[model samples]
Target: MPTSPTTVLIVGSGPTGLTLAIELARRAVDVRIIDKTPGFPRSSRAKGPNPRSLEVLEDLGVVGEVLAASSAPLPMRKYRNGVPIADAAPFADARPTPDAPYDRPRMIAQWRLEEILRARLAEYGVRVELGSELVGLAEGRTSVTAALAGGGEIEARYVAGCDGGHSAVRKLLGVPFEGKTDETQMMVCGDVEAEGPDRGFWHQWFDEDGAVMLCPIPGTRSGWWFQAGPETDASGAPVPPSLDSFRRLFAKHTRLPGSGLSDATLLSTYRVNERLAERYRVGRVFLAGDAAHVHSIAGGLGMNTGIQDAYNLGWKLARVASGRADPALLDTYEEERLPIAADALDLSAERLRATMEAIRKPGGGLDSAVSERTNGLGGGYRRSSLATGGGTGRLRAGDRAPDAPCRDLATGTPRRLFEAFAGPHFTLLGFGPGTAQALREAAGAHDGELRAYGVDVGGPHGLADDGGHARTAYGIGPDEDLLVLVRPDNHVALIIPPGDLGAVGAYLNGAALERA
Candidate 1:
């Protein structure tokens, strides 16, 4: 421990924990992340990051590595009675637009994604403390004291529980995890080296009894993800997942030779659990990711939801820890995320039922589970109290701020709106010429905390929108002179006229006690 207290103490080193650690570390917040595991596990629990998560990764400067290491979503080749019957590409029609650069999700191992995040965290001189498990927690009026498993204690200004669904922090706070676990719907999942399936398509074999899916793992020559309904014993107890058990299941379902599958690793039995924490925070301790909520894996929203949770809480924690914002601002975390979690649970449940029904039909695949809602672009904090001020055009307060192609006026270099929104500062976009004064005032008032860019204003910090993509993406008319204030997480916080510049200051003031 250092002479000064840690700013944030993050428990667990999964995607959620790693994400929060990076967020706080990039802001120069003294953050300490710990995981109970003795060493990092190469578990590919979640398939990959969704489109919205790609945006978050882009901000964290790791999307390039992820893209380089990942493969696009593959088409599913469905087989009936061990014979290939149908091939369906779920995201074949998906294409990137100026507003949304990533149209489809990539297929990368979860462990690999965590490795990338951990490497990025190291760049900030922060590393995950392995085998450091949190056993006890006591919150003071201003700080939290965490008890580690090995007879050591750490004091942090704030504590974030990024541990999985079985979060010790959430349990220590006595928060009720209210949900049901569907034991009847259990699947054995693992990573294996298989010889039968080609790496071109996600192969699925269906029969009257059940189905087994094998998806080729990106960045691996012979690796495949094995998933299927759990095998049962005579007494109806699920046989624990093992390499031999996985081979038996594969042979039973796919009619492939048992010797074709070997080197099975990261085996686990997954029971469909849909649970949400009763509360996200108690005093200075907060829960995020699976610590706050867990959902069905049908829509692949479980990990993405957790990542977004860390994204939402990271800046608020940093601000409050630095005294840049009032402690009350932290309450908005639960207010906005709880509803989103509830919605995700319902959506996943619905998708699970629909997918199960679709699987019963011949040549039916998981393609029935794909929809616009699963893309991760439509989620926003529209009802959040932070979303104030009236909307302009088709865009509204609390909507995700869309990106567009633009150019840096000063250097004549090409740039995108995402580049402007990157980093740990608020972004204020002035749509037209009338917003020049507003942009100047905002920049002058909040120098380091905010970045104000004028689109077509022909002034300092003006962006040259030669293609008019900026205006079209933001839904602003050619002559429209509205200002859109974006939060650190890239959500539109406010949309107001240039003359109502006072509202911007008022909103910021109301959210925090004072500007540091």
Candidate 2:
């Protein structure tokens, strides 16, 4: 039987799926999310959100709660022969700046992050339909019909497969998940209680025989993430991950007593894999997160990249699915995100190799590979179809729109550019008082779809860049008249020249987002 149609049918209820659901739900789009499992996964698989993902969370209004429930990345404490050898903080150099608020990656479990996103979606009167697995997909030019494993089928204007690397949707679509998996390198991981290692640092024990790492899981005093190589029996067969196996690995590598381990759960074996889908979009159906790409967990990017994939695709989907923009707007999702996924795959592979090499030494835990690149702040969509403008300024169209502390000229209260850019509307910021007339005119013209703010040196309305923080962060000068049109996803969509009202109208009208 055919169910009622939805604007978007999102398969898989992981971080990417949850984030996409919230993004569409908050926009009032008819989005439905589903998962194959009957219950939520309790495994604290992915460690945390990276800096860029945190920025996205802030926009989605969940960053505060996430930070409240999370902790900072722990410093790695390397030990040799049960003796502390060295200590290093890989994220020490990451500091918040005016342009970027989330400088450091925040450590929260992936399952918890998904729960938070689900709550946010619930705020919009939406909930994930768990156990409603997609068993088949029939893609058409304008819509898709997804067959569920249960009984019925759901038809939607568009379908997004936010499912993981082993995505059934991808397989049915015949999308080649192209990459290599290193069978030689396998990691046995589990959630266990360890009383021996201090929770302040991520403890790593190394000996000529092997190595084992135990990192404290935030929000729990007794829980720690244990990872080690596979243990072989007398027959040289790999031992399965169990409480006994984890205890044995810890006792063999570290001087910690076997009694230190208890309540071992969420145990699984991991193989080093690097894979990316041949494409992100196929007709009206699309892929995001692990469905599009999967890589090593070295840089802790598996979840972060997936969250960003949803972030980039969310607004585009919302707009297109709502008829706010042309269907061509949907194409940019792959154009902008595919390259980043490829880059992240390579970076994760590189980081994994670097850490592996570093592990062969005495004072090597997280070495040069753990740099600012892993924070995921520098990525931008300069070459995307939705982005334009170049030549000058500190930033360009397609760059991540910067946030700045400013003053609201109306009430004389402090405000943030990010606060203004928090919703699902285009943000137009006009620099200096000279552009007030044009900004006010544009705001009146495009009242709801595009919000216009006057960032002035001394204007009576809109935002004021006190001490020039806004100007510096936006890379605008006091004299140079500029207008930046930031997309709902916080990417600069178009950089209009001074008083280019025609360009604004033309772009908005062409994109079919010209409301009010």
Candidate 3:
């Protein structure tokens, strides 16, 4: 029998699916999220979210909880043949800017992060329907029908597959996952309990034969993440990961007793796989996160990329589902994200090669792999069709709208551009007097779909740039008049003259986002 219909059916309850569910639920869009697993796993595969992902969490109203549950990235304690050699702090000099609050990624177990997202989703009256598995998908003229493993079907206006690398949805879509898997390069990883290493730093052991790395997991008394070169038997075949094998590997690399390591769980083998799906969508069904793409885990991009993917697709899905935008708006999902995924594959591959090389040398460790590029702040959609009109100074259409501190004119309270951009509505910022009329017109025209604010122009919706950070961040001169339209995802959709109301209208119309 078919169940009640939902606006969107999210397959998989990992970070990706949870994010999409939160996005939709917050917008009052009916959403159902399911996971094949009976319950949440205890695994902590991916370390944590990056800076960009943190921003997404902030908009979703759960960044404070995440901050409380996570730890700052620790320094790396390196060893050679089991003797401590060097200490490296990759993010020692990293600091947050006025516009970017997070300078580096936090260190938290993947399971903990997922728990936070799930809790946030619950606040919006949505819960992960565990034990429900998606076995098949059928797209109709207006909705998608998903077949569950247990003799049930769910109908939804859209379906997003955020399932992992071996995604059933991708297979059902018959989309080719085109990429190579380097079997030779592999790592055995697990959550473990160990007695010896200090928890202050991420400890790494290097030797002629292999290496073992262990980082203490946050929110756990003795939990640690263990990763190492695969253990092989006399036949040179990799030994299957287990408590015994994990203990043996730890003892062999760190020269610690096997008895010191215990309670090994979530054991798995990781091979270098770089795969991207041929298409992100087929009819009303779509793919996100690992279902859409998979990459090497070098740059810590796997989970963060998925979080960002959900963030990108969330608002667009909400608008289209609510009939506020044309169905064609959904096409931009693949157009913008596919290219970014390709670039991420290349970046992670390059980072992997470099880190592997660095680990081979004396007194070198994974800390050397950290850099600004891995911060995930530079990505933009400048080449995207959604990036319309001309740019001013350093910022242009499709770039992330940077945050700036200011004062709200009505209440004279301190506020930030991010605060204005927060929520499911598109934001329009008008700089100087010339933009005031356009701001008023745009607000009157779009109503609930858009929020218009005037910067440095005193009015009901005016914001005073006390520190001048807003103008500088947007690259506007002291006396200039500019109008910047930001998408629901915080990316600039257009930058035009203050009085060019036609440009704003054209962009809004062309984007097919007018409220019905």
Candidate 4:
């Protein structure tokens, strides 16, 4: 055991914790991350990363590695007695446009994704401190002292609980994790090598008795993920998961031969539960990922939501610890993320119920109605303190700022609007003439914190006119010449329609811009 001091200490080295570590470290914030597990697990639990998650990964500079290790969207097929009943490719129908690069989700194992994140964190000269369990915590006005299992201690200005379900940190804080545990919907999941199916697609078989699903594991020969509704024994206890038990269940449901499936690994039975912490923050201790929320595995939002939570909190924590922003900014972590978690809980529970109800019917198709809300691109904080001005037509405060190909003017080189928005600063995209001076003046006032770009009106270097794609993307109308201020998270904070430079300044400095 080793004692240490850090500005921010992250508990649990899962995706969320690792992400926060990388984000804070990128800003030169001293961060320490620890996990109870000695090493990364080799399980194929989470399906893959969503589009919005891809954006976050891109921000961390590891999107390329994740994409390279993942498989593209394959058609999901629902079957009856080994025959295809219904099939659909959600992403194929909703093809990705330039505006949204990852319109579809990728299929990759959770362990592989964690590996990529760990690698990225290594680039920052920080690695996960394994075998370090957080047993207790004490917080003061200025710092938090975390008690370790091996009698060591860490003093951190802030502590984040990225620990998964049944988080020790959450328990030590005495936060009520209120939710229901559905005992009836028990599921057995595992990674296995099987010969029964050559579907080359994710297959789900549902009938009167139960359901069995199989999805291919990317980059593994004859490897697949098996999930089946649980079967109770004579005493009504869930039959423990095993290769033999899985084969027997598959045989009973799909009439598939038991001999075809073999080499079972990482088998575990999970009960569907929906729970959320009463509060995200308790003094200097905070919660993220599964520590804050847990829900049904319907839309595969579990890991993605956690990653996004860390993304939302990382920069703010960095800003506050670095003395750039006041501690009041920390409150926004709960204000913005808690609502999203609540919504996710409702959505995941609904999706699980809908799927179960659909299975009860004779010819019910898969309920693809699971809200794409967790698609990363759709989540925003328009209600935060930073948002200003409400316009009916375009330029709303709560929209995802659009990206476009624009010239640097001085450099005469083609660059995307997102490229300019890449750094950790507030970006002002002005799309009208006679405002260059205003943009320059705002940039000068904020110095390095604010950057303004002036786009010529009715010029080729400006927005494309095809349906005002760029304007609509930025939430500004074709006729409206506006200055759109984008937050560091790529969300629109304020939209000034031509005549409100003073209002933008007020929004930035005043309470109009919340800490989150």
TM-score of each: 0.97, 0.96, 0.97, 0.92
TM-score of 4: 0.92
lDDT values, one for every candidate: 0.89, 0.85, 0.89, 0.79
Cα TM-score of candidate 2:
0.96
Clashing pairs in 4: 385-512, 385-513, 385-514, 386-513, 386-514, 395-475
Model 3, 185-242: lDDT tens per residue? 9999999998868999899998878999999999998999999999999999999999
Off by over 4 Å in 3: 511-516
lDDT by residue for model 2 (1-516), tens:
578889899999998999988888888999889899999998799989988888899989999999999999888899898789999887787678887888788887777887888899999999989889889999777778999986789999889998898998899899999889998889899899877678999998877778898999888988998999889899988898999988888888887787899999899999988999998988988999999999988888888898999988888888777776777877788889999999999898889898888888898875445767898888998877666554245788788888899899889899999999998888888887677777877788888789888887344448888879888877777787777888888988777665676667667655422221
Candidate 3 deviation (Cα RMSD): 1.9
List the candidates ranked by TM-score, beginning with the highest. Answer: 3, 1, 2, 4
RMSD, each candidate, Å? 2.0, 2.4, 1.9, 2.7
| For model 1, the run of ten residues with the poorest summed lDDT | 507-516
Residue 400 error, candidate 3, Å? 0.8
Writing each residue's lDDT as its tens digit, candidate 4 over 230-295 gives 877999788899998898888887777877898999999899889999999988889999999999
lDDT of 1 by residue, 1-516 (tens): 423378899999988889889999999999999898999999898999999999999999999999999999999999998889999999988899999999999899999999999999999999998988889998888788898887888899889998999999999999999999998888999999988577899998878887789999999999999998888899988899998888888889877798899999988988999999999989898999998998888889988888899999999988877887778889989988889899989999999998888889998888887788987899888878888777866788878899999999989999999999999999999988899999999999989989999999977687999999989988889988989999899999888899999888877666422321
* lDDT of model 4 at position 245: 87
Cα miss at 200, model 1 (Å)?
0.6
Total residue pair clashes for candidate 4: 6
Q: Which whole-number lDDT from 0 to 100 does residue 439 have in model 1?
A: 92
